[model samples]
Target: MNNSLDQESSRVNFYIRNWLLGILFIISVVGLVALIAPPNTNDSMGYHMPRVMHWIQNQSVRHFPTNYTAQLFLSPWSTFTILHFQILSGSDRFANLVQWFAMIGSIIGVSLIAKQLGANRYGQAFTSVFCATIPMGILQGSSTQNDYTVAFWLVCLVYYILLSLQDETGKHYVLPIGVSLALATFAKPTAYLYSFPFLLWLFIVKVKLLRWQIYQPALQLAMLVFAVNGFHWVRNFQVFRNPLGTSPDYIIYTNRAFSIPIVISNIIKNLALDISTPVPSVNRLLLNVISGIHELIGADINDPRTSSSNFQLNSLINQEDLAGNAIHLLLIFTAIAILGLSWKKKNFNYSLLNYILCIIAGFIVFCMLLAWTPFHTRLHLSLFVLSSAFVGAVLSKQWSLKVVNLVATILLISSLFWLFFNETRPLVANSNLLKTGRVENLFIKSRTYWYFVGRPYFRESMIGATKFIKSQQCTDIGISFNKLDIYEYPLWVLLNADTDKKYRIQHVAVKNVSEVKQNLEPFKRFNPCIIFDSSGIIFEKIPEQKGNYEQKWFLSPVSVLVKTKN
Candidate 1:
C-alpha cells in the first residue's frame, strides 16, 4: 500500500513539473481568486441570484408571480446549485464559484475525452489549457451565468458516450449517460442540440445490432431524465399551455421570413462575432460584412425592428473588447492544418470522425431551426469543447516536439495576458489588491471602485436606492423598471439581508409612469410601504390629493414613492 501510494504521489509530482501543467496551475489559481469576489454581472444581479433567493425564501421551487418572465420560466438546475451554496453560506460571496467549478469540471471532462480519443499526456494538457483559456469561457466561468454550467454537463455527456461505445457491456453505462443527459438538459435547453443527435445514433446502432436488452436500460434513462427535468416542463405547460413557455416564432420572429440566405448570413455573423478580437480593424471588417449581408437580405441593419436580432453584432462593433474566446479562430485553423497534414496517414479513426461530424451537423440544424442571433456562439460551446479533443489528438500525433512546445508557450502567455489586462473587468484588480492588505478590504474597495469609478452613475444609483430602501424600514416594497426584470439586484440583496423572515418584496412590470400608476391599483390593497422606480420616473397621486403619497429622490435619477395614507 505504501509503495503504491508513493508511486501515485511521484506521478503527480512529475506531472506538476511539466511546463504546461505549471501554467495551468497558475491560471487556475487566478480563476479561484476571482471567484471569491462578489458577482457583479447584470443577469446575475438581476435575476439569477434573485431567483435563488426567492426559492430559498419560499423553501420550494413552486411558480410565483414575477414580472421577470425569465425568472419564472427558465430552467433552474444551475440555480438549484447556487441556492445550496447561498443557503449554506448565508451570502452571495460564492455565487460565481458555481460557474468557476463548472469551468474546472469542463477541463477535467475535456481531458478525459482527449485521452479516449488517443491523445497523450502532453496533448491532454494542451486540450485542457486551450479550453480553459477561452476569453468568454473564463468570463462566463467567473460569473453566475448558466452557459458554462451546461457546457460542463455537455462535455461529461460526450465523455460518457465515448466510454459506452468502447465498453463491451454497454448496459452498465446507460444509467450514467442518461443521468448526464438529463442534467445537461436541465441546465439549459441548448443541451438538447448537443446531446440528442448522439443519443439518436446510439439508439439506431443498438437497433441494428438487435440488442433488445438495451431497451430496458434505455427506458431507465428516459425515466431518469423525466424524473429530474419533468417538473419544470410540466409547470410550463400548465401555466403557458406550451411546454417551452415561449414559442420559437415568438422568440425569434422578425419582419423578414426565415430563408436560406438569412440563415447562412446569421451563421457567418455569429462565427465572426465569436472569433472577434480587441483589434479595431478586424471588428470593423466583420461589422461591415454583417451589415452588407443584412442589406442583401432586404433587412435594414440599423432599424429598431432588427436590433434585437442583431443586438450581438451591434454590441460587438460598438464594444470590440466584448470578444468571446479569442483563440477560437486559431483553434479552428490549427485543427484544419493538422487534419490536412495527416490526410495521408492510414490509421485515422473514421467512426469518431463521423460521430463528430454528426454532432456539428445537428448543432447547425438546431441553430437554423431556432433564431438568428449573433450570440449563438455561446450555444456552440459544446462544439468548441469537442473540437478541442480532436485538435489535441491530431497535434499529439502529427506535430513535432518543438512545434508543440512553441504553441503551448504562446497559449499560456495569451491566457495570462487576457486574465490580467483584458477589457472585461478581471476578477481581481491588481491595483486594489496592492492597496489593501486583507481580502475583505480588497472586496470592499473593489466594490466601491466598480460602483463609483467603473460604471459610475448607474451603479451609484442602484447602491443609493438600496441604502434608501433599508433606511425607510419598509416591510413590503414594490419595484418597477422600464426594462421590467433587470437591475433589481441591489434592492433584493439589501432588503433580503436586512430582515430575517418578515419582509415581502414584489416586482410590478410597467413601461412608463402612467403604467406605473395604473399597476399600483392591484398593489394598493396590500398597501406597499414603498414603491421604488429604477427607471428614473416620478409618481404623484392621480387626483393630486395632498398627504396621500410622498415622493423623495433617493438618487437624482432614482425615486421612491412612500405611502403615508391608505
Candidate 2:
C-alpha cells in the first residue's frame, strides 16, 4: 500500500513537471466540444451523410441509383460508422463523433508506433501531440471526413506490423495487421497507395523471419483483407463492369497528365499554399512562380476553363485558418536536421531509418503521380501521422526531456488557440459561451454548432426550400443539377424524417440547358410533383409543360418548380 501511494505520487509529480500534459488536455476538451456539435460541412451534407441515411433507410448496403457516381461507387467503410452511430443514437447529432474518435485513435496509434520504434514515454507523448496539432487533422477530426478515419487505420496497421515483427510466436499479431489494412483500404481507395509498400515490407520481413510457415499467415492476411473489402468490389464489378467503378475514367478525363517539372512546381505551390503566411511579398513570389510553371506547362493559370480545379486549390489555401502548414513544415525540417547531425552517431538505427525513408519517398511519389487535388495536403494525413514517429525519435535523442516538454507545450497551446479563434470562432462567438445547459438548447443557441444548420448554403436557402417542399406535400421530387450529390443530403433528411413510406427522390444529371430539356421528357412520366433545378437548367418552362409549372427560386440558385396542373 505504501509503494502504491509512492507510485501515484510520482505519477502526479511527472504530470506537474510536464505542463504539456495540461495543454494536451485543454486541446482535447476543445476538440470534444466541437465533435459533439452537428456536422454541416458541404461534403458531409452533399453525400457522406446522405449515403449513410440511404443505407439506414434501405436496411442494407446495396447499390442505389444516384446521379453522383461517388454515392454509388465510393467504398462504404467510413459511412458504415456514421450509419451505426445514427442508428444507435436515434439522431444525426453524433455524426462528427465518428471522426473525432478516429482522431483519438490516430493519436493513440502514433504513440504506439513511437513506442515500438524505441521511443521513451516522453517521446511517445510528444509524437501523439504533434499529430494532433496538425491543422487539417484537427479540422477534419471535428467534422465528418473519411481522411482521418483512414489515417487511424493506417497508423494501426503500422503498429500491428511492428508488433508482429517483434513477436517471436507471431500467431496473434498477423490477423490484426490484415484487419487494419482492410479497414484502411475500405475507408478510402487512396489507402492502397499509402499502404501497399508497407504491406510488401511486411511480407519480406515475414519471409525472412518465418520462411515456409510464413505462407500460412500470409494467406490468412490476404484472405482477411479480401473478405472485409471484397463486397464493395464485387458489387461494383456486377454493376459497373469494373471493380473500381468509374474512377479511372473520371481521373483520366478530368485531370491533365503533367510533365515531371509541372508536377514538382504544383507540389511546391501546394506546399506554399499550405504553410506560407499572408505576407504580401511572399504571396507575390509564390504567385509568380506558380504562374511561370503553369505557362511552362502550356496551361493557363487564369483560364476559366481550368478554374474549377484552381478554385478548389485557392479555397483550401486561403480559407483554412492560420495554422496552415507551419507545424508540419517545422516538424519535417527539424527531423531532417536532427537526422543529418546524428548520422555519424553510433546509436542510429539504420533499419528504422531506411523504413521511414521508404514511407516518405513512396508517399511523395504517389502524390506526384496521382493526386490532382488542390487539397492534396489532406491526402497526406497518414504520411504525416506516421512520420511523426521519426520526428519524436529524433527529438528524444537530441533534446532533454524538459526541453521536449517545453516545445510540445508551446505548440499545443498555440494550436489550440488557433483552432478556437480562427477555425471555429465564427461558429461559437455569438453563442451562450458553452455554458452548462441542455445539449438541445446548446445546439439551438450556437449558430455554428452544426455545419448544415449554421452554414450559409444550408441555412439561407436549403432549409427554406426543404420546408416549402414539405408544405406543398410533394411525394415525388426530381432533382437535376450539375453536382447533385453534394446538395442531395438536406433534401433527403428533411423529406424522409417522419415517413414510414419513403419519398421517391429521382436524380437527373444536367450539364447544360439542352440536357435539361431533353431529360424532362422521361421525368414527365414519373410526373414528379416538383422539380428542383440547381444547374440553371430551367431557363423557361419545358416545351412539353407550357403553362403547367410555376418556379419558386431560393438564394441557393435552386428553383422549386411546382406543377400547378398535375
Best by TM-score: 1
lDDT of 1: 0.64
Error of 2 at 390 (Å): 1.4
Task: Please report, in order, the local distance difference test score of every candidate based on alpha carbons.
Answer: 0.64, 0.66
Model 1, span 261-379: residue lDDT tens: 65565556556667665456767787887778877776555443322354444333211124455465576567766666656678876544655565667666654555555555556
Per-model TM-score versus the true fold: 0.83, 0.82
Clashing pairs in 1: none
| Clash count per candidate | 0, 3
Please give the TM-score that candidate 1 achieves against the real structure: 0.83
* Model 1 lowest lDDT segment of ten: 312-321
